[model samples]
Target chain A: AQTVTQSQPEMSVQEAETVTLSCTYDTSESNYYLFWYKQPPSRQMILVIRQEAYKQQNATENRFSVNFQKAAKSFSLKISDSQLGDTAMYFCAFMNIGGSQGNLIFGKGTKLSVKP
Target chain B: EPEVTQTPSHQVTQMGQEVILRCVPISNHLYFYWYRQILGQKVEFLVSFYNNEISEKSEIFDDQFSVERPDGSNFTLKIRSTKLEDSAMYFCASIPPGLAGEQFFGPGTRLTVL
Candidate 1:
């Protein structure tokens, strides 16, 4: 069974600063996909960034990026130039490359606070 | 940009009552899925539907739960009898191409079983 773990339950960063949220997963399949999602107090899950297992290049989206260490099974999200609007619950998710069921397995989530 | 839309942003019902959550995935999408998140808990997968049938489901998706694409546009999840523990935010997502593709999520419906 594949499981995603977000060790950090909460995180805080000053506006204009940077913060990183840690994530790890257990998967036997070599080919898969990793994702970072942000859910605000409204409880809407929004896709932030995605990383393909086969790509050594980490994924970057404007201000959000990922440091994907496949060997260690670590996929961490880094938010640079953090803003107040960035405060939300962040989740790490996993999905198989090819399967009939394309559902994503998500972590417990990390509550992020962007302090001004 | 096209997005998935779910109806009844919030629903409160007595325990043992039946509740149906509806979602309209992107028109071009093929695979649809349902996930739930209990307050302060991880988002858990419930079931996946494709080709108008269930492709897969989790242990949490027991006999009490069923999904249907009754029409060409809408997807629905019906709980035979809602329980207190079933109260959570239900999310509806759809995969644009197929597996290996990114999934787009809906705003989610908060189900409160009282």
Candidate 2:
């Protein structure tokens, strides 16, 4: 069994500033993947970024990045130059590398609000 | 770009009634999944279907729940007897072959059981 935890229930950031959302997981499997998803008011879950356990190098999108600490079982998402559009519910998810089914286990999610 | 789509954006049904949620996965996807999220809770995986059969399912997916791909393009999740606890947003997701862990999600269907 795998579990993902997002300790922060809510977060706020000023426009153009940076914010980091925390995430932790419990898993016995060594090869796996971590992901950050954003659900805006429209209720669409959008993929933000992804990180592989074997790859020490972090994954970075245009304005989204992750700090993946394999030993610590922590994968946090950092949003740079935050915009109002970034305000959404952010979730951390985990999945095994290879298997017949690749269902994602998601965290409780952190609600983020970006203010001007 | 191709994306997963779910029909009946919102559904309200009485307890003990049956409801079927439909999904159109990405055209080239080989694996399909169903997940649900209660209000203010984490998303929980319900079941995964592949090769026209169920590959895996979670404890939350009981006999009351079933999935099928009756046609080549449409995937469906059926709840035989809806309970009040079944009120949640049901999401459909899909993954292209060889995409490892990248699963694209649909906009979710909000199910309200009264």
Candidate 3:
């Protein structure tokens, strides 16, 4: 069984600054996918960024990026030039590349607040 | 952008009553899933469906819970006997066939069992 852990319960960043949210997972599977999802007050879950375990390079999308360290079993999300709209509950997820569809294991989540 | 749609954004039912939540996945998606998140808790995977059959399920998806695709357009989750612990936000998600597909999620239905 794979378990994702988000050690930071809450994080705050000033507008236009940068912040990093930490996440770690325990998985024996060599081939897997990691992801970060955002949920606003609307309760809609949105994909922020994803990283393939085999890919040594980190994944970056707009202002969102991930620091994926396969050896350490760590995948952290970094939001650069943060804005108020980025405030939300962020969750880290993991999925096996070998198994069935859409079976993602998620972390408890980190509530991020972008203060102006 | 294509998305998954869940009906009855909110559902309120008494304990021991039956409740059904509906979802519509992307038109071309091949995989469907159901997940739940209790208030202030982690999102937990319940079940996954593909090819009109259950592909995977979690311990949380006990005999009390059932999933069905009665028609081409609608997928449903039924709780035979609701409990107070079942109060949570249920999200429907889908993923298209491919190696690197991302699961798109619906807005979620807030189920309140009193």
Candidate 4:
């Protein structure tokens, strides 16, 4: 069984500032994938960024990046140059790349508010 | 961009009534999945479908729940008898064969069981 934990229940950042959302997971599988998803007021789940366990280098997608520490089982999402549109409930997810099922295990989520 | 789409953006049903939620996954997607998120709770996986059959299911997907791909572009999840506990936002997702871990999700159907 795998579990994802988002210790921060809420986070706030001023417009144009940077924010980091913390996430940790417990998984026995060595080969896996970590993802960050954003859910806006519309409740549409959108992929922010993804990092593979085998890839030592972190994943970056424009303003969204991930700080993945495989040894510590930590995968945090960083939003640089944050904008009002970045306000949303962010979730950290885990998936097994080699399993029969590719279902995602998600964290409770961290609600981010980008204040102007 | 290609994306998954779900029908009946919102559904309201009485207890013991049957309800069906429909989705149209990405045209080229090979893997389909259903997930639900209760109010103020984490998203939970319900089932995964591939090859016109269910390949994996969670314990929460009891006999009361069923999934089908009735047509070439439609995927549906039906609840035999709705319960108050079943009220939540149901989401449909799909993954292309080439993208092993990327699952694109739909906007989600909000189910309200009273």
How do the residues B1-114 of candidate 2 rate in per-residue lDDT, one tens digit apiece? 888999999999999999999999999899999999998888999999999999999999999999999999999999998999999999999998975778999999999999
* Candidates in order: C-alpha RMSD to true structure: 0.9, 1.0, 0.9, 0.9
Native A-B interface contacts kept, per candidate: 0.82, 0.87, 0.77, 0.85
Predicted structure 3, TM vs. truth: 0.98
Backbone collisions counted per model: 0, 0, 0, 0
Model 3, A1-116: lDDT tens digits are 88999999999999999999999999889989999999998879999998988899999999999999999999999999999999999999999977656599999999999999
Model-by-model DockQ, in order: 0.81, 0.81, 0.77, 0.82
Best by lDDT: 4
Q: Fnat of candidate 4, please? A: 0.85
What is candidate 4's lDDT per residue for B18-109, written digit by digit as tens?
99999999999989999999988889999999999999999999999999999999999999889999999999999999458889999999
Q: Show where candidate 1 strays beyond 4 Å.
A: none
TM-score of 1: 0.98
Q: Is candidate 3 or candidate 4 better by lDDT?
A: 4
Residue-level lDDT of model 2, residues A27-80, one tens digit each, is 999888999999998888999998989999999999999999999999999999
Which candidate should be chosen as best, given DockQ against the real structure?
A: 4
lDDT of 1 by residue, A19-99 (tens): 999999998988799999999999999999999999999999999999999999999999999999999999999998665
Write candidate 3's Cα lDDT for B1-114 as tens digits: 777899999999999999999999998887899999999999999999988999999999999999999999799999999999999999999888774558899999999999
Output the better candidate (1/3) by DockQ: 1
